[model samples]
Target: MTRAPAPGHGGMASTRTHSAEKKRNSVTKAPTRLWGGRFEGGPSDALARLSVSVQFDWRLAPYDLMGSRAHARVLNRAGLLTDDELERMIGALDDLEAACRSGEFRPAVADEDVHTALERGLLERLGALGGKLRAGRSRNDQVATDLRLYLRDHARQIVSRLVELETALIAQAEHNLGVAAPGMTHLQHAQPVLFSHQLLAHVQPLTRDIDRLRDWDKRAAISPLGSGALAGSSLPLDPQATAAELGFDAAAPNSMDAVADRDFVAEFLFAAALIGVHLSRLGEEVCLWASQEFRWIEMDDTYATGSSIMPQKKNPDVAELARGKAGRLIGHLVGLLTTLKGLPLTYNRDLQEDKEGAFDAVETLLLVLPAMSGLIATMRVNTERLETSAPDGFALATDLAELLVRRGVAFRDAHEVVGHLVVWCQVNDKDFDDLTDDELAKVSPHLTPDVREVLNVQGALASRKAYGGTAPDRVREQIAALRAQVNDHASWAADSEA
Candidate 1:
């Protein structure tokens, strides 16, 4: 791939303006060549199109301008720029930002990337003073710094969306207290579990995703501004000053690694991929539960969609989209990692591939999260159907086995007894409740009238009151714990911005 012109070389116009009138006219003059005294002529049309990244990267204009402001301050501190020059440069940058925000400033066909476009804008505003701002900076370190700041801000936004989805889960769990459903393993009914317990299972992984974002932020906080074009800058620059001004924890220790490292990007994509997987799991369940065969829940009209031809059809489009989008999220992660896998120990054109994937992953999640939270919040569980089906498919067979174990039978013997009872019920088309005491005795010598006590679904549910169990009490306790954790994370996210 064709690489755009790197920064911090001999690009800007020479600072030799003797006449004040000529300098004033320079501000409105056509932009000077970004690469001066090098090539004989312009690049090929194909090369320019292939190298331009300002179209997609224009979103980084604000962040690039922010880093430039910090860089200007550092340059002034190092006495490389006079106070008046620094003041004019900052004022021009402020004007550029306002124009960018108002859509009045944008990349032209000649602007190769965000850095170049912003440079052109600054020159248009302040002439030679704008040229001075490029002294101690390079697009290599500038792009790196801008990306970190952008990801830091957007990661917090993604976390807040996750918290909203988590809060919706906890609320649903609390509201569905005491409701029972058939828990499945391998897509077959296994046991009776409180509906709340299943909801909390989804919340557990998302809480870890939130923690991953926090951990990723810590590593991404180091600034790379002074690592000019893969080596330390020649100027008497204060990297720490710029780091502090940009809200970074510190400067990166190595110039080569500082410009080349993309671990933070990969880590963020991994977090997003996992979240997509989690949401896909929820989507699959919602799709199953909302179907005619299950009828365990109903999607609200706001989230569900009608078939184009079939007027009676109400499809769970949001859940299906969530499930489908998971593959896209995984694709983004894999593509980015593949791009980073073979690069050398410095900045390269291939690194430009990183931003689009990460951007897609972030944008995908930001859109999916609120839709998911709304889907869960507006969904109505069919409590009567859930409660009625909780005991079907021999779901209480485990309870029968445990009851026999309590009556002094060995566990192996109890398991055998329940296995035989299940086979009998399956062949005869009769449930466990259909059997009388004599019929039960005929199946096992350990049978007794009190065995009926554990045969009911509620008895089976209450019997497992162990911590983290699906019992109503245990599920309620889990709901409370999750709520506290979510609230704590929300507070931490707020303080991160502060």
Candidate 2:
């Protein structure tokens, strides 16, 4: 074999030489495979087609390059490369990163995955010296490291977007404070509540979702970079150093677990799925409220869609999509869990199945969150309609029962009394407000004229003044508390990006 040129003398000159050679032999020269030095021949065409991952995983190139930079530092500390070689290697990686970002460099047809493609880029720049960077690490650990970094970065982004949605909710609540609406149990009006309280209910789940992402980051912060192919490297590599350089809390403690563990991905999928479920519920409400039967809201023209055929239609498409995509997100979570269930310890080819679901889920949420936020921020609430219909379905019957309880009637007796009054009103075609004192006296002895005190929607709303209740003051307190939470989450997300 012809001897390759040495490193220092041909650094930049080698790049130009390799670039020209790459063009001249673009079709004819066989791409280098990361493994199979001992094999007599290349993989079969079918095997190559089935094994390829460069398409979806190429998005991981930035994180992969980040790992490579930190790995280079560890290799230099291990004395695997001279200081000058490390410097040259870091420079080459930076150049390659710029190329990747600008789309000048990309995976070719034969490149199996991101690692192979990036390695090719490095080799093109530094010639044989580029091959030295792979020492003391395997694709197993490298990929695990890349994924953790990718998720950590995205978790912060998701939190930031979540806060934006929360902020929209807070604004709507503040604007509509003290507006009373029918609160339901089992979709039947049970009581009257501040409309702000209903809007704030959606914020609670999103806050927990943000908390879950923050909590998930704690477990995901440990790096797996130095675990070489499910076994520790024989070389004197410093994994803790690599972990710190890459912003991981520490190195993974077990070699086999480092390469094999995908619990982080599963947990992320769960968080994402739960977010979808919560949004689905919110979407269901939007659909109902915008319907002619409810007429509780009117969606903005920008957010609502016009029907192709029906001139009168202004469809809640954003809310419908939110409800529809929830199932897709749920399927991604279940699919990943099923994929992970029977996986044996250490890395397997099945682990390759992890990235696409995660990538798609993240992309889905990133797309959905901003749209949902805009939908909420821009839509108009029909406060008059909500307030007028607040007590239409005997919504204050419970308040009437409780009012009798305060007047020394046993709750059971009061409940029976209110039941009779509701039946009497339905039969007589008269609401409680329309009942005369003589009519009230005939229904029950406890149905004195003063019973009308609890019959109106505003009185029913004001009666529930306990903490976390639907009273106006309580709902204001709840809104303040949520605003504080949104601020704290916003700060945490900002710090994480920093």
Candidate 3:
């Protein structure tokens, strides 16, 4: 009998034959199942489609590998693996990690989830020895630990981006320190405020967001690695050693709680959603400022997009997307909360619904924060327009009222006098600067010429000397304090990354 030619041995004929043989092997191979010893047959195609999560959870591959390494060490300490076996296992895992990072190893079509795909890779590398690593842990505890590691790493990234945005706001405030703008109450000018004051207002909410993330980290640092299935393993595995190896503060106190708790994910979603809301508010202002009607800011050509139909248009699409994505971020939070609301779990299939939304939320904020920071940093402020419009719509009327109060006039009476004076000025088509001595006396005897001192925009802005006020001096102090806070937050984020 003649033996078949070896693959790639004969020119084109051998290459074609090799391709056919590889295709046949792929078609005939069955997926490795992690569990199913009790089942008589495979799951239906419909069940398989619904159950597979390797598409999204595959992003957790790195974290999953880290968990496996830690588990291998713990198993070695328990004498489940010999010293030679442990070293071999570590070498194989390191090779697998390189393949994963280089995109050479990936999930096969039948892989159920990240864990199953990674296990298959391990088996391919080490054969029967790979099975030993799964001795003390279940997918239940494994997935829980992987997600915490994933979120903990990404949370630092989110904080660093937040600090970048805050630093941009601080830079804008410092650059426009002396500029004045009309501050609005009901979208109508209410007072003359230093432009720096408005920019710094956004920084305050972001500081709180950073604090929330830092606080959330404290609760998310516990490991769940040895919490097998639900009730923990009966083996001699050391969970504390695994937790320390994985960078967790401690192993979970209770195995059931360890696998079932998704509160960390929910809390993270809340923090992300609130950051979205704050960005939405800032984006709304950017949209208004960039419009022709406001013209308080001019969008930089690099950051702003042009309309395809309107050549003259420099649209604030960056800010508009920031506004639009806030809704998407909020929906992710609510969707995850709804998924988690009814599950009575030690570990239920419903819990698998958690990863996609949390992953998307983190990715969305990471995208939005940097774009917004560049927009704020590069946009040009129209200081002349801001100062010119600062005292429009009788914005200084409150200053006049307060002046009368300081002269021993009752506040109620002073308010009444200022109200009438505004009416007279409106009907006569004149502002406070246009008012004659005879006209002031007729409007209100208390409208003495001394009131003129506070009627102008400069005087209106300067008179607010109280701490936290919009006075230029107060704004300078606020900027200094905020800079120190941003520096501290930057240091915290750096430590987290380290």
Candidate 4:
């Protein structure tokens, strides 16, 4: 229930009050406002309500404190603070962090944002010396620095989780090796493919997503700490030193761009949104495969829920949520892009809209990636159903065409022949298996009984022996490649954290 003291209170205590109660009251009195030099009055209640961001941005407190610590070192290097003052400042910040961790510190309603609250906490801890911490920094640059640091840490976390999810997929593919399934085009059964091939298809895009996070991290690694407001700092501050302290790769090249650039956030949102879309596609399959019509997979009890009204009804709530949340993730990306689009230059209060969406996305994927991985890891795959379904719906039609091509029939002629046969089968309520050699030969002289060799599921699978194809060996190669890629990222994420 403890709140940060109001602006300017900065925890300054008056020692001259005679009565103990009066002395306590005087100690807790609001101090002079940090930016009240020209203002005759404080912000209106509505303005305060509209402006305060600490409610959500408090998650950035640790990053803010980290930035402050880095800034403190830079300040000492600039001779803005003595070594003694720097020592006291670090100790006080450490105490403030402990208080924040223990729930002993929280933002006051009067505080505008986390920056304001932490400044107040620091002032309370070190009195006047705490005031020096704000000398060469503006909240604008400090917030930019904090957001980058926060996202860098979180991006690594996201990478690690992605690796877990990828590993789960690799395991699933390895477990279900050579199990055949119907692959689709436009949601209609188009071909017979190994279940492992389908699983590795999903793995390919996720690998690119991890690559995107790694690429974004490189750009986001630059420090914006010494970029005062929208211009470079007047003081002789060493941005490289600050960057090194905060684990950034370098200082930002342009101070204005440094303060105003939210491309990093937009890129992160885009990455998260794409991740959502990928997971939704995976979720849709789970929902489909778990249904009575498909019955290709049995939902694990741990990852599925039963309906309240129906005794026999098990609902795919987890998959459904993952599918639904994709829209939310897209909305977050669009909303943030819109916020950034119209801003003219430099820092704007509108930038306050940035943190919540980014934070929600990070937290959301943290849950979703693990849940999806667990769902895949534990679910029972009905390989019999998958194999049985693989050759149905004339799924081997393409293989029939290819077999004709091998028989020296022109591809166009083969395609038309197969197309006609497909319509004929549909109208006659018969499948390729029911076709007579005479009937097939009537359509094309080249359609001999030997063509029947390629009309079944195994032949359909074996014909695709090219690299990246659905043949068992190719799929095994894909899984191995995917595992190596996942392992590389896993190593990078672990090393980066170290």
Q: Mark the regions of model 2 whose C-alpha exceeds 4 Å error after superposition.
A: 1-28
Candidate 1 lDDT over 207-231, as tens digits, reads 9999989888999999999999888
Q: Report RMSD (Å) for each prediction in the order shown.
A: 6.4, 6.2, 7.2, 5.4
The most accurate candidate by TM-score is 2
lDDT tens readout by residue for model 2, 246-323:
888999999999999999999999999999998899999999999999999999898999988999999998899989
Candidate 3: tens digits of C-alpha lDDT, residues 302-419: 8999988999999999899999999988998899899888888688999998898898898899999999999999999999999999988888999999999999999999999999
State the lDDT of candidate 4 residue by residue for 72-105, as single tens digits: 9999989999999999999999899887776556
TM-score of each: 0.93, 0.95, 0.94, 0.93
Greater lDDT among 1 and 3 belongs to 3
Candidate 1: where are CA atoms >4 Å away? 1-33
Candidate 2 RMSD computed on C-alpha atoms after optimal superposition onto the true structure: 6.2
For model 4, the superposed segments whose C-alpha errors exceed 4 Å read 1-28, 31-33
Whole-model lDDT per candidate: 0.85, 0.88, 0.88, 0.85
Q: List the residue pairs that clash in candidate 3.
A: none
Better of 1 and 2 by TM-score: 2
1 versus 2: better lDDT goes to: 2
